[model samples]
Target: MLASLAMVGLSLMAFLSNSFGQERKIDQIYLDLDKKYRIPEQWTVLPFELEDPYKRIKNGPPLVNVVNKAKVEWISRWIANPKKVVPNAKMPDLGLNFEEIKAVIVYLSSIADKEVPQVAWDAFLLKKDDELSDDEYDKMDKIYNSGKGVWGRARCTICHPIKSVGGNVGVGPDLGEITTKINRNWLYDWLKNTKSHFPDTMMAQFRFSDSEIRDIVEFIMRDTQFMPEEADEEETTEAKPEQQEIQVLTEKEFSSIRKDNALAEKGRDIVEKARCFVCHDVKGIPELMPVVEKKRDNLAGFEKLLYEIRCLACHRIQEKGGTYAPNLTFVGNKIKMGWEQEFLQAPDIIRPLSQQMPKFNLIEEDAKVATEFMDKYLLNKELPQDVFKGEAPSPEIVSMGEKLFYDKGCNTCHAEGTKGGGVVGPNLATVGDRLQPAYILSHIKNPQQANPQALEPNFNLSEDELKAMVGFLVDHVKKKEEGK
Candidate 1:
């Protein structure tokens, strides 16, 4: 009923704008209505299936291969208190006793399909750094540093938050103390074939070479940042009672109980009672709760791309998907289709500090399909077409806008040119080639109205100021060659 009322309001606004041939303040109206009707930070049960991709996604990694992925000790710690291990862990502490945890570990080991692939490392590399000769340590350090460089170039932090920092894209796990959880072999294998391990992962498949993969594994394994901090023994003693020591099933202890069928059955019972299947895909477990799988067999065009890339994991479309990335409800009316298509294929840095589109290795056809769909369906009809009357703003307008740009201190957050500026907002160097003139006007007029989560403050520019600003921004295009 609320949706119908919203639609009616939108339709009425569109009719008024078209009949009078005047630009309506639709953006402000929409923002007002959205704030009033669409409550934030509250969960409500929709009557129909909204198909929120983030909701469909599992917070925990698939447990089928978890035995191979994480160490038994790490698993024990995680089950005890997930937040304690990784500050940003989505998993809750199951509150299972030591014996149950031990049984669970045994059961997991029993169900393991494959062992971690043995990568032959140099004898010195496997040895402790102190045990290694100076030459060996130097060689290891060189490889570690090289991997660190590769890590930065790949922009791993764009998706992954480390110590609750940097996952602006908001898809990856908190990998701050990753060394405590995963072994070097598992990390290497997972990096090599992430899809093979978890088919539903939103992580992009980077085209890294074998050497690069190995280097990343090395860097992650050896890096102090990835490792857990050693607890101060005196402080630890004062903090907790000795009786409160969490029981962990060591590898040796697990090896003994792993083959015990009775224990495995008990573990299965515990898992069922805990409803672990709700978050994890546990093999050899019967359907205690039946799940209806959404059919993706018939999905084509942009829908297929959306599912494959899991675009909804970051981007929000209407009431579906996530809010980590920009809202795409009216992207067609905001962005230039040509630029969007190109960006989908080979993305460039827009927001230098936070937002970055991962290189998904999308084909040209994929980009075309995505952009075409967005252009056709995702638009605001009330926004005036041909905002500048299909003509470039005069030099005077551009010059005034440029002056206002500096006077308004827009450069503090946004960079207009390459030489210097802040990285907090989108780099506006070639924004003219990217965003539509209409969007520029609307965005400048009211930033929060355009994007609820936007940090860009509304300058509340007057009509002339708004027009001039938009003109200046739209003029910031890449200069063409003289011959061209």
Candidate 2:
């Protein structure tokens, strides 16, 4: 089988490196081979080992380091979905060979700024290749100079803006801060043969000669300025100390910025820089946002996405979702704001559902923003006086609703305050105090209207039946609250 052959190859490589002789190049070559198969470079560089990945860093190493937790999870996922990655790749039936896993394990176990596991790995591990030479350095300016022509003529400027002066598609990530976070050699490798890094990363590999690549890299690395001509002007001005004396003094004298939500904001900057909204939903707002695709037709687009996602598939807000998720309509009252903020930064499996929740790999700040957003918008607001204006619905209505709540299988998915409903939906311990009457009214009128084609049944109640149901739902909360 192909898996058998791949394993043989991996074992042979392992033998060559570990048993045959201690030649490190065997490992290096294997690493390179492994590198070719990666999508999104599976490997990453982290800034620090701190709990926070989005911490503001002054400066140190030239590239980011991979977070161990992130790496392990990715490995687990790769094991689960191997065929998606390797073409004709079959190995020990686990999608990855023991040798490959072992090598990666060693890399994962080691800390950053320290020696990595593989032999002769010091250079790559330390990113020594990231350093640029004097001639290479000298050419950086030239690259910037020709950028106007190169970026302008290639149609790249049309899709990707430079200094906010070009296209609107945002097909490419912002490049202004690219130099600060990524390895220089990565840029080279990306320019030279991009697909080799991550088959999924979209940047196309242009048929660029080494000289052209150098030109492009230099243009990209000029730091603050976009034009080589402007860089010359900056250099001229910087040479005169007297001209920048006041500015320098102002910078040194500036007071440190202290804000009410400094830690949260500091985390936010990193989230925006990483641009986490490109794919996964952040869950704090009215609806989730996709990362790379846009749904543009306004109300129609919003309606289309809600219907497609089937909110009830994984979540319940009122009467929608899969039996494997949680109801979120009343989530605001249940959790502390700051805790929500922290969880968004890095979510751990607190309670596993039948299906594992997918991680968005959100940077810390994106998590914070999600936390802040949910706390602000998703919670309850009292219903209009006209709605609550009537006395609480009759006890018969409450009794009937309660009977329907069970007969219709409401408890099949929702647990009473984490009691016995299917773990798939929200716990209903405090729903009464958490949702406004109008909120419930709006949701039940058209389960699809509140959220399109919501997994919850569109009970299709007549106006009188709807009123009975609303009265029942509204009363369920108050009774539960009192019992608690």
Top TM-score model: 1
What tens digits encode model 2's per-residue C-alpha lDDT throughout 152-235? 334454334554554333334334334443444556666665533332332333446666655555566554543322357667
Per-residue accuracy of model 1 over 6-64 as CA lDDT, tens digit each? 99999999998898877556688788888756734323222233345566545555677
Number of backbone-clashing residue pairs for each candidate, in the order shown: 0, 29
Instruction: In model 1, state the lDDT of residue 280.
Output: 75
* Span of ten consecutive residues with least summed lDDT in model 1: 41-50
Cα deviation of 117, candidate 2, in Å? 13
TM-score of each: 0.77, 0.29
Q: What is the lDDT of residue 36 in candidate 1?
A: 55
lDDT of 1 at 101: 87
Q: Model-by-model lDDT, in order? A: 0.79, 0.44
